[model samples]
Target: MELGIFLLAAQFEAGDQGAVLTAALDAGCAAEVAGFGEAWIAEHHFVPYGVCPSAVTFAAMLLGRTDRLRVGTAISVLPNTHPVLLGEQTALLDQLSHGRFTLGIGRGGPWVDLEVFGGGLERYEEEGWAESVDLLMRWLTRRRVAADGPQYHFREVPVVPRPLTRPHPPVIVACTTPASAALAARQGLPMLLGMHADDTEKAEMIRTYDAAARACGRDPRGVPHAAAAVALVADSRTEAVRELRTALPKWLGLGLPAHQTLDGHPRTMRDPRTYTDYLCSIHPIGTPKECIARLRRTAEATGITRQLLFVEGAGTRERTLENIHRLGKEVLPHLQAD
Candidate 1:
């Protein structure tokens, strides 16, 4: 199994935006030094859900700082951005990073991003999102492209300065729903599963995805899907459990934003206690031995070989750094050996 760092770029009470951004990059650098294989950055807008609005730009910035750790957009919110522009920028990044970039695309959230980015959710839901993905895949892989879907119409245009990585860098999808999982399976793309689901739920979802892939005549075993969970490795189980219990609630609160949309649409409210139970049930948050057990259990249940750890959010930079280091030194090797 391989471990990767999942950065949320969360803003806490300190609210030092500069320091927070710097710490996020520093954490990636630290993860690279700690021997992580990949670093995934998430994109969000108009809220503290995620401060990094441009994941591709952030991936480029991280590439400049680290040498070997492959950087990826955990998702680049396809519905919110233009396919051509995203393709161009991603192709450039692929060249600049020496084919060390991965493109993880997803439909925009139901939150404020669609409205704020000038397209309504209805259009994206109808056809816009799928069309954007199709156009992006064509732009990255083919020389000349023509897209005349319901939501997008374009003549045959060359994807100038084509991606250095043949067939383009690995394109993963953030599969949130069963439909999205099936779509990814049909496309033969890997998926990034969120941390919200329990082990049983995740395993069932993966089974559904694999079955769908097989139904579409694709080899399900070849698809590499990653399951994410908030991880905090500590010296002792007691210490880790205490810290996680306290931070989990705070993190859940941040996941659901406090503010409303322009027309007064409220964020999805979550009870911390309920969310905490769901989180702890799936996450590996304990001593090295305990964490390893949880990770192994998850792998066994879901048949997922890669686990992305959410190491930063609602904690001191120092605390987050320690968690990263512990995960690398203590938790990673055992899992790798297995």
Candidate 2:
């Protein structure tokens, strides 16, 4: 099994944005030192849910800071950016990092981000996502690319500094719904399942994706799908859960209500306390032994080998780092042995 940290760079308090960012970067370096294989960065705009506005840019900085740890965007919102420009950046990062970059793409929500980026709500709701992803795939896989779609119409241009990895660097799709899972399957790309989902939900999504991949003549068994889950390790389950319940709710409370929809759509944010309770029940928040059991069960149920753990549920940088190190030293070996 491959273990990695998922860095949201969330601001749990009302101060020091730079400190939050520094902590995220420090965690990425710690992942490498602790013998983890990868670190994924999240992107959010105008929300403390994730202060990092550009996951790819953050990934580049972390790549520069670490020697062996692979860095990837948990997702870079596809509809809000030009595919060609993103492809160019992805290619450069992959080449420079010696094929250690993974580009995870997603159709972000109908948020104010589309309006701010001039993409509009229509782009988020319509064919823009498929068109953009298609163009991006062409850019990564071919020597030159062109596009003529409702969202993009362009002349053929040569791909400069092609990705260093054969074919291209790994591309994973963030799947939150059946449609998204199908989209990834049709493209024969792996899926990145979110932390909010349970094993049953994730297994169903994998089934949806697998059936779609088969329909498209793509084998799904070989695809290395990744699952994200909240993680914290302490002396006992009580201590771990108590710490997360207190800190995660505060982070969620400060961050969730900040999202604004682009088209005046009604958006109901999850209740922070309730959501925190749900996460503690479903995720790996306990001693190392209990964490290992939870993760192994999730993997066995979902057939997911890649684990992307959200280590910041404890809120503070010190506790987050301790969780990461404990996970790497105590839990990872047993899970990997399985």
- TM-score per model over all chains: 0.94, 0.98
Global Cα RMSD, each model: 1.8, 0.9
Give candidate 1's whole-model lDDT: 0.82
**Tens-digit per-residue lDDT, 1-338, candidate 2:** 88899999989998899999999999999999888999999999999988999999999999999899999999999888998899999999999999999999988898999989998765676367777878899899999888888888889889997998987889999999988898898888999999999999999999999999999999888799999999999999999989988898888988888888886766898999999999999888899999999998898899998999999888889988998899999998887787
Scored against the true structure, residue 140 in model 1 reaches a CA lDDT of 89
**What lDDT is reached at residue 319 by model 1?**
88
Clash counts per candidate, in order, are: 0, 0
Write down the TM-score for model 2: 0.98
Model 2: weakest 10-residue lDDT segment is 121-130
